[model samples]
Target: MDCQVIFQPSGRRGTVKKGSSLLEAARKLGVDIESPCGGTNCCGKCKVKIDEGYVDELSAETHISHVSQLTENEKNMLQPQEIRENYRLACCTQIEGDILVFVPEESRSTQQVVLETGKDRVLRVNPAVRNYFVEMIPASLEDHRDDSERLKAALLDRYSHLDKELSIDYTVLLSLPVIVRKGKWSVTATLWKEQVVVALEPGLVEATYGVAVDVGTTTVAAYLCDLTTGKVLQQDSMMNPQIRYGEDVLSRITYGMDDDNGLAILHQTIIEGINTLVTRLSKAAGINVEQVAEMVLVFNTAMHHIALNINPCYVGRSPFAPAVRKSLDIKARDLGIRIAAGGNIHCLPVEAGFVGPDNVAVLIAEEPHKQEKRRLLIDIGTNGEIDFGNKQRLLSTSCATGPALEGAQIKFGMRAAPGAIEKVRLDPVSLEPQYKVIGEADWFQPSQTIKAKGICGSGIIDIIAEMFKSGIIDPTGKFNMQQTSRRIRRDANNKPEYVLAWSEETSIGSDITVTQGDVREIQLAKAALYTGAKILMKKWGTDQVDSVTLAGAFGSYINKESALVIGLFPDCNLDNVVAVGNAAGDGAKIALLDKDKRVEAQEVADFVQFVETAVEPDFQPQFVQAMYFPHGKDTFPHVQHILDTIPTVKRSKLEAL
Candidate 1:
């Protein structure tokens, strides 16, 4: 018998044999389903809910079935409690007669991070879009001039500063005649940058909006703001759909170069994400998509090329440069952005090498150029970008720091999701560990009480710092053997590993341990971060930073103590180091609201002296020194003392209980 399968929301349908699984039917329909486990039902990602047609339509005894009964693996994977909520693993469930399935957002691999607003910024209200109410004479038989010409004459006469030719868009022109007749020769025209008319209404188009977009390699975020009022109406974010092709910029470049139409594929993926954000933002703000009249985009150099559909193969090579170094203003429709067709999209200035408009945006948002003391801005991610200077001088560089800090390339590593261990600390003498997972409110005092999933970046940093401070790991990050802690053991590869969560205490049904290799990834990442900062410091001729601000999602979550103990950056006053939040996104918002800030961003970009780390002398030695704790010194004594003295609140609470 043939079973009819219908996918919800999209309304795509296909027919399959009764024994065929839902995933097989979805594949036949060419739907995008994330089967990262390759249909093994391991990832627990292919989840769906049955809405209709599951039971026999003609049943005398009220029989119900959607497919075969749940498999043993599926039962174990999804707890019995979740099945009652209409959840089923798509890879394991089969289609029985005819049924309809709903794929929620969580089931999709293109799941997005929650959209976060940048640091609070108060923007000036002067915008490029202006509204003018024009009154024109009715075309009479004596005045044989056409309606369009008469309207243009009135605009020029009433507003002396108007261009001689106040041309309206063809589409707007077609509607202008009817609009004037309806309003009795009075129509509101939305003027863009003095030359062209964007929108027209019988009365006034009171609400015009614009979007500020931050194009991250992992996620893309959009903020919808009122152009005139400078009020942000709505914001949303999603995982860059390009993630399925590759994880990092280097991998994406290789993918784009190796495959035919690879550039187009990557380009379309980001476009799809931006358009999706637009749709969601408009709906959330109770406005039409056409109301959004402008956009400001900021991204890294690689993402910059891919979004513009330009080939970025050269950016991956030496003496790296982008297709363009200056800011660009293009029509939103020209780039397939479904806002107002004639609306403009403004991109900030691109710095030399891998630094793109994002660094410019960072400078604009931070305003370090106007500050008194010397300051440093560090954006940590796949590619760590650092900017240092005072009002007089500015220096910048980019480091290829890979994605290890974001929870990839480690055993039991995962995103900062529910159940992931986000904070950890080990006792100095007893060598006992206490931790907190992402979802649970209370700490895991007993490892068996809370099931450990995996470790994220902050947890990894804390674990290593605590391990080093407590003498469980030596200064070089090697696991100390003299302690003879039960939690320490050798893996199959004969590497010393420290188990944070034992097999019975973890969701993965195995020990969640940090191996020697995991420690090395952190060392390499921190070394890159330190070396870049050192290069800028040497250029500034100062070993001490007046202040440091960590910018970005990962940077915001990292504990300052852990960062210092790991030697991720040079030492300064502990209170001076602060996480400023996503400054790049904030800069994009600034540029979107005020055109003058775009000029300021350009000035910041021009003033910066780009230092190429690869060619700089003393980089290798600094990098090698950076690999050790506190640059292989006996520094961080205060940090070690803090670890020995101040215990976790969880530990204290458990002790009191």
Candidate 2:
């Protein structure tokens, strides 16, 4: 028997065999679901709601049976209230009959806010690929020269800078005779590095373009640029379709190591994603795909390996060695990229261990190596990349901060989107919260009828800081049980939580609250990040940095004060703390327009030293101390005055009571 299934919000419908898991149905129907554990049912991230009844598509009758009884694993993983609301783990639940399921925004992997634009700089327009229009004399009986030889001679005659031993792509050479004859011995040749002809056109084509891509774990962004003018023609971004396999690099690596076809699937998926971006960008810019002759890419080591179709199993193991550390120039056709047939794809050099070309890109964009004062650069994401350096030396490392800070592994958390709370401020006296949702221009008001869906990463940070400053929670991330307020109460599981939005103010028909578990998740995530920064500073033999730069999409939106309040990094002057949006993407764009910058990228990759924090003996203790609000022993000189204004209950006094 076959069961008809419909997933809401996306409205995707499909039929599957009876007793198939909901996760299997989602995969078959092309529905995006977060399964970071690779459908092992251990992560408990793939949650879906089942409607009580649905009308049968063929019989026109209401069917009540939808799913099998909840397994013992679901009973242990889900809260009591969630069970009552018909929430089931998609990996555990099996379809018994026709069903209508609703996947929550947090569970779905699409519609995320992807950051694409970055600070632009004046670039020296020396692109590796250039176009040259050459007019040659027709071949006569006396002048018996081969087509390839004649074309090379004519190119060197017109452009003295071109190499005398220029070569043509075999595919391009096959069509060269027909194209040159059709144009009456006049043609435009696209040469790569002024050495090899990658493409050819019938007439004098004046336009040339290239693409710069930033392949992130969660999102992929592409920039279409005019190689001649060094101007960005069009930009587009999309949620990385590979998220369906896993959310983090390690998970994907595990998937690859455990399954035979995992590496091939991941490689093909990213190629398809890039091809989709190329198609859209070319169409929007009114240019043919063949006209785009070059591409530059940047990503972390695991993503880099997956993009290049290399086995990443070793990248997740001890010592964490990458297959290659040097930059590569591969043919576009070899990678199945939908660009010019013989176009070249240039990948930036990668650093050792987990520090990859993306981190190197950050170094080039910020130029910390050129500054005299010590600088700390942090790119915050699921895996936080940290770099500390000055003119004398540079150090780099990666921290496994997990996905908690990005609204994962927390109750009532979601990505930045419409109806998601982005900012929050609580009153010190009443402990009442005022918030701003993503789609709204103003703070929440009583008369506005705003229905917040969930809290995003920035809002989660703000609320945690506000709770600490307002004395709602202690430094150890425990709810102040002695405080009396309507918003402060215990859940059905007897756990304390502070309500951010009442049931009437949310579309979920339930109150959104910050649970004790949520605070612990944030604490663990922040502690890992802070610990990594501390390790780098120790390696540099300094207690303070002259300046701090936050990079990435999430880092750009973080409130500096709130980040300090949570001890996301080591203490620094608030004035010196700056957020540079998408530095890695900026580095990719810079490399795309300038051929010299690509060489500089390789130099920077070799100059930086990678420190492995996992092997450090003091990591556990430092991580424990950093779990406290603003740290247990470290003094935050710049933000201490703000913390001093708030009154808090002493833990000893509460214990005595």
Candidate 3:
């Protein structure tokens, strides 16, 4: 039977066979839904909420059903994330009847958070584009120069250091006569780098604006900045629509290589999202869309390729080559971004491999090369980028941590949103759960409905780290299966699981539990991060992790105690571990605002030694050792304070009856 399906917000419509997955229908209708594992039903990134047309009350269905049964994968995936209430894994969920699907902003994980409120640096205010109002002699036959040559003379006379090879959009030549005459030969000219004229107006303009963009795998953040005053007028962000193709960069690369039009679709998705933001930010800031005269972007190499519509076929293959690693100046028009017609988009330099300008951007934001004390900068998202250095030199590396810690690929994992659990504490004596959700400040008992949503990256770290300290889980992240509590039980697969919340207590009508599989996901993610940092330490010939600065939204929200207890990275003084919010985005802004800062960013990116984890000889062994809690023996002198103060129970395994 053909069943009708509708996607909301976009108001897209389609039809599919009764048993077809929503992802399949979405693909048929050209709707974007991310499946990073290529729809293997492994990554839980393809989540969609059922808005209507499904019967949830399974009571006495008369031996029939409207919604198809959840696949074993979907059933196992939703419990830990508590998404079973109304959401389904779109890749695995089949439509049995007409239904409306509501895709949340978090499902794509592209919604950018305004991680910082204030600007970080001061600039010299020498911008590339400047508006000059010059009065020209109304041309007579005596002053026989053409309109273009006449304007060029007037501009050069006013500014002697102008480029001799000036160029401009043909439209500027097409409209120059009317503009010059309309202002009585006294017109305003917008010059870029004193080279090409980009815009012409009848009078003086107050400000020239620019945009600094962070094109992440799933999210994009844009800052509308005042180029003249170096003031941030406003900022905007949204899920990178490319998330419909994949939640991770490699998946996106596969999408592009697998389909001829995949590259175009990926390019169009991000361009549309950026254009939408440009319009929104301009209107909100009370500025004309054409006022934005320049843009700067920082992306991981894969995102950089996809954003520019370059074929990413070689990025994921052997040798791991990138299209280009140098800084580029691409015209916004060529990239199809909506801004001033002749505006330019400057991309900062990229390091080797997938560690592109986004990594460089974080370094620009952190300015590690300017510091004297040894420090470690970790920007962990679906992937992890590390920068370690002081004033002498900077060392960096990239690691594929996957999306587990970001809430995808985890059974009960979810983004930090309204009902998503962001904090957790397990009682030592009772082993009952106390947790907090996003959008709520106070801690609430998991016995309450709102407190029992699926866990987020930070909460996952907290629970596992706390379990290690409380003797519930061992250094290897194994559960003491002998526990007598009713909360611990064996699932149908005969694997041990711990219940975080009962069915009635959660938004979902089923218990939210962490399985043995869930623990492994955490182990894998944390190990990647720790190993990367340790490799740098090993290369740097230092056993000490002087300081650690966590970057990005997920890193900022993570509990430092939990991160330390789990050895998310090499050991550092607890107080030295700090969160630097959205360093990559901030780096883009720094380049956008300061010309000198852009040069510095390039120098730092170029000078820093980039270590590729894939080819590193000792990386595999470090990764294996890192899988154990607190790095299997790397003492957490800082974590000992919590272990001593907190009422941790003994590890006696319930006395074996």
TM-score of every model? 0.81, 0.95, 0.88
lDDT (Cα, tens digit) per residue for candidate 3, span 445-478:
5444454557778888888876777566766778
Candidate 2 — what's its lDDT? 0.87
Candidate 2, residues 322-369: lDDT per residue as tens digits? 999999999999999999999999999989868888888888888988
lDDT of 3 at 590: 81
For model 3, give the 10-residue run with minimal summed lDDT. 55-64
User: What CA root-mean-square deviation does each model show from the true structure?
Assistant: 8.1, 2.5, 4.7
lDDT measured at residue 375 in model 3 versus the true structure, 0 to 100: 93
Candidate 1 minimal-lDDT segment of 10 residues = 55-64
Judged by lDDT relative to the true structure, which candidate is superior, 1 or 2? 2
Distance from true position, residue 617, model 1, in Å? 1.9
Off by over 4 Å in 3: 1-12, 16-21, 27-38, 44-89, 92-119, 445-452, 643-657
Which candidate gets the maximum lDDT versus the true structure?
A: 2
Candidate 2 ranges beyond 4 A from true positions? 1-4, 17-20, 36-38, 52-54, 58-69, 96-99, 104-106, 446-450, 649-657
Q: Per-residue lDDT for 8 in model 3?
A: 63
